[model samples]
Target: MYLEKLAEGKTEIGESGLPPRPPENFDMTKFDRGRKFIQDHVICHVLAMFISLVCGMSVVNLLEPLIFTNNSDTPNKAYRRYISTFMHVTKWYYGNIWEENNKAQTSILTVRNMHNKVRKDMTAHEAKIKNSESVDIDSLNHERIASCPMAMKDVRLSQYDMSLVQTGFLGIVVMYPRFVGIDCTEAELDDFVYFWYGVGYMLGITDKNNICKEGFHITRDICKEIEQQILIPSLENPPSQFYPMAKAFIDGGNIAHKNKLNSVESVLAIGYHGMNVKLPKLSFMDYCRYLFLRGFVIVIYYCPPVKKLFNKIIRHFFWDSSVLEKKMN
Candidate 1:
């Protein structure tokens, strides 16, 4: 019955799915603590974002149109798409998120608009796939679509899908913070989860179906179930598109960093191997890069000066300082 309620979100399309307002009785203290959590551990949160993205490749087929079929045609465009994502996510963490017409609110609406466009495009594509003759189905296309657990079910992105995505962001950081070198208190974690609950509401996830709606412990348990049941399983049995899509996303990350050495694969490799997920053998050079990244993560996390310096570099490279100042003020 619980799963059924979440699955129902698949049908709650368009603006109708969004809550009329943000979550009520907003705990500003908790929200501020959550913002501090991210601010204090910026490098860890950034690392967690990469880890989440790689894990998200598990739903590549469900996300194909949003990814492959969108602004990812060229390396430069892919870079822009991811950088925009980083900025939006940062705004959610740092800005006057719940305030009307703020960066966070506007960013969530922009994302919804983008989702609507994809929903329209996928509707036509889904129909084409359903009506096409078997003889017209090529091996590559068949494999890609067949890999989707939600294939032929509904071309539109569902609330259930958004719930899973919400997990991608909140999961690793809350459940396995140490994976990204985070060492925080339980109360702080709760505050962080509380912040995202409000974010979930603004992102069209109904209170009943919001991944983070249940507060800290329940949300953690839910994220644990998703990691054990869906995310890990998907990683263990990914389709042909998984590697390509993951590589494309990492390539964009490299672009954002303006240095290929800062590959998101560093996080992916460590996280997957830690989880006992089987991966193809990598070249010797790839292994060397992973080693370098491991060392980099360690130095940045344990060394405060290095961590501060790294944070400044990231802000300088990807964000507008003025926007942060304005939102924060």
Candidate 2:
């Protein structure tokens, strides 16, 4: 009966015994590109960019809260000191990241264990402080981290400040990509988000404060709430006066561009391009370029043998032999 209907021109296939054709002008190149994308190791390149963003953009937020604090107060002094130590942190990051799958100077498990231990110590210490009711909280940790800044100074670090630093990585890498940044598919973004949330758990982020578990939109909304709820300086509660921690990022970025022959620019550009995101401070032209590149990056995945070549470069730079691996248990 189906064949008879088709023979009588009662079916879309007509008498040809085949499905109807698409319009002649329908570009086969679209389908070809789509097929090529599926065949190519697109996920590998997306992940490479993800790691690259981690290494590169993580520095950008090192000086936040500077706008709200001064040098004398603990928050001001503490955070500036934190940024000053960022170079050392980068060394630890490189070690943790580049040593292939081997145990390294700063493996995830190693730092995670340390973070957990520190959290345990802080809880006990807090109980002691509360019970004593005699010691000033400001005097804890030798007045380094001090109370306030949304984080208390614990055994070693400020819990609130460290929480911010920890979540900053997840925010830039996962949340921004959902709208303003690169073209990560939902699956790739979710996997990356989930991985960091695991790290957050390992690092002792409390259920109350861990922001990375929420999906991207909710996380961003949380960010806006934080910005609003930041306690602005009142006459009674002035910002702690202090020297600037690092130079303003723009000043430092420009100076580095000048002195370093744009090694700084090159790294920053990876975040800029890899995410298809330009800072809002940049011009409309830059956003247009980002939009153009969002589409263009698809071509990158489809290039002949490029995924293999890109993966080789990524391994050479970030996954090769490392001295740090010697310390692994």
TM-scores for every candidate against the unseen true structure: 0.83, 0.40
Tell how far residue 256 is off in model 2, in angstroms.
10
Worst 10 residues of 2 by lDDT: 10-19
Per-residue accuracy of model 2 over 90-201 as CA lDDT, tens digit each? 3333333223553333454455454445545555655665677666753534133232242333233333434445544544444444222244576555554444443444
TM-score of candidate 1 to 2 decimals: 0.83
Worst 10 residues of 1 by lDDT: 320-329
The clash number for model 2 is 8
